[model samples]
Target: MATTASTAAVTSLASVTLEVADLPSARRFYRAFGVDTYVGLRASEAPSTGFRGFTLALTVSRPSIVDGFLGAAVDAGATVLKPAAKSFWGYSGVVQAPDGTIWKIATSEKKDTGPDTREIDEVVLLVGVEDVKATKEFYVGRGLTVAKSFGGKYAEFAAGQSSPVKLALYKRRALAKDLGVPVDGTGSHRVVLGGTAEAFTDPDGFAWQPAA
Candidate 1:
């Protein structure tokens, strides 16, 4: 986060707005993707290439739910960046939207406790930052409280009950690697974060606006 020191405004991440080229197509895609209600959309021709320096992740209770989300995304015209698979952490998959936004569906649980259901545990917005320590300091300097910190590698902020989206930071290259994308990217990030603040732009050029 950057600019004026408005603690309350920048503290909790309230919403996410994705700038897309075609509103109709994007809406249709997200509607099929089962996350349209979680995000706001606007039409913009921002010329972004390669990785966008951020990812919106869906955390679920089991691997089957992860498979369900990823599978739906694929059936809805999303490109598979990484197939659903288990890793050291758990099961997950990566997909690219038709409008070029990247999404991750994952779970820390290895197996399902019961039948698979479309239950999303949480939605996290992870921004790829240049320095996790510095950014952590920046957010902490505001009203944001740190929920978890891992050296200079990553940081997650505690979100209020009113906040629908959680904010987190990770190293740029490492985030790209985790998202299965190249580390090279240029131009607008094409995504805006909405919070209590009227408007602000982060150090990496991620914009923030007031939640509608």
Candidate 2:
């Protein structure tokens, strides 16, 4: 199990690969959001269905920025699951990626008291797992350090000072409720996380592929 003192071996989120039926369309949609996404065309399998048990969160510094991002995503053909609105946490919106992945674009109202950059400053890949504690231990055992943790609720891993993206784990049911989705998500995740120590699938079936 990973302790608080575990060293962080993962540095950055190298890439997030999405398996798409129509690769070109998926590319166009994500590229509009400034994500240099790597698309892998499905050779034989049918397209995935329903939620994939995770959501990629793009965090900015202001409320207006959330509207801009959500608008851009809608313009680029993303399906808006939740419209941009001010919530207790901040302003946020949800969109389903063209490749079937869900994304939550948000900004903290408490933190965005200064000038607004209106630009995405950080990316947090939130993986919904059946057990937050056990999953946190799994990553810790693999040499990732816990930056913050709330017992059985959520846990965040330190992705180094210079890393643009960080990794986080959350309880599946809680995450599903927050996203207004079902707890038992069906079909493929359609997402791949690259730049990890080993290639393994988490309890909820999110794949962490090795860095190329």
Candidate 3:
């Protein structure tokens, strides 16, 4: 079974969507500012929306849109990831920030009520530690409360107010076994947990802790 994170217990995600004109140029600009980009597809619902004039549509439009959407955010200095790119799917590219906000730039492809309903349900945490209790204590110290407990095997932490990220703790070995892969806790891998919060593991051992 796949482990899950509890967003309801954690902070809630603040989200927005924007339409963009260009993908590659926007991506390049962000890169110059030192923001990493993650290439993604245009929403299948785009074509139905009758949107044109751009190869992709960012959830948050780049250039003026981003500046306006982020407002004080840019002034506060947010890290730029990827600028943008044209995806293989014919739609343009988009990127996300450390925040759950998604920046899309491209033409709408198709229209639908929403994407597939089978999206990830929760973010699962694979903790590498000799003692589960100690790790649990570490997060609890981080102001997260225990929402559900699975013996000593796993625990899902409740998010605090305004926190959109959900936290889960699992024995590293157990998680690997469940995924049908060799357990290597020493290295790092991106764990894209499900639910409203978008989570990932970046390079370095540092976890991409998402804000709720």
Pick the lDDT winner: 1
Write the candidate numbers in order of decreasing lDDT.
1, 2, 3
Q: Candidate 1: list runs displaced more than 4 Å.
A: 1-9
Which lDDT tens digits does candidate 2 get at residues 51-142? 67788888888877777778788888888888877878878889876667778888887344555455778888888888999988877766
Q: How does each model score on lDDT?
A: 0.87, 0.73, 0.36
Which candidate model has the greater lDDT, 1 or 3? Answer: 1
What is the C-alpha lDDT profile of model 1 across 1-212, one tens digit per residue? Answer: 44355355466887889999999999999998889888899999989898999999999999989988998899989999999998999989999999888999999988778766988889999999998998888777656789999999999999877776799999999999998899899998989988776676667778877888
Model 2 residue 13 lDDT score = 51
C-alpha lDDT of residue 44 in model 2 = 21
Global local distance difference test of model 2: 0.73
TM-score of each: 0.94, 0.83, 0.35
User: Could you give the candidate ranking by TM-score, starting with the highest?
Assistant: 1, 2, 3
Backbone clashes in model 2, listed as residue pairs = none
List CA RMSD, all candidates.
1.7, 4.1, 16.2
User: What's the C-alpha lDDT at position 108 in model 3?
Assistant: 31
Span of ten consecutive residues with least summed lDDT in model 2? 37-46
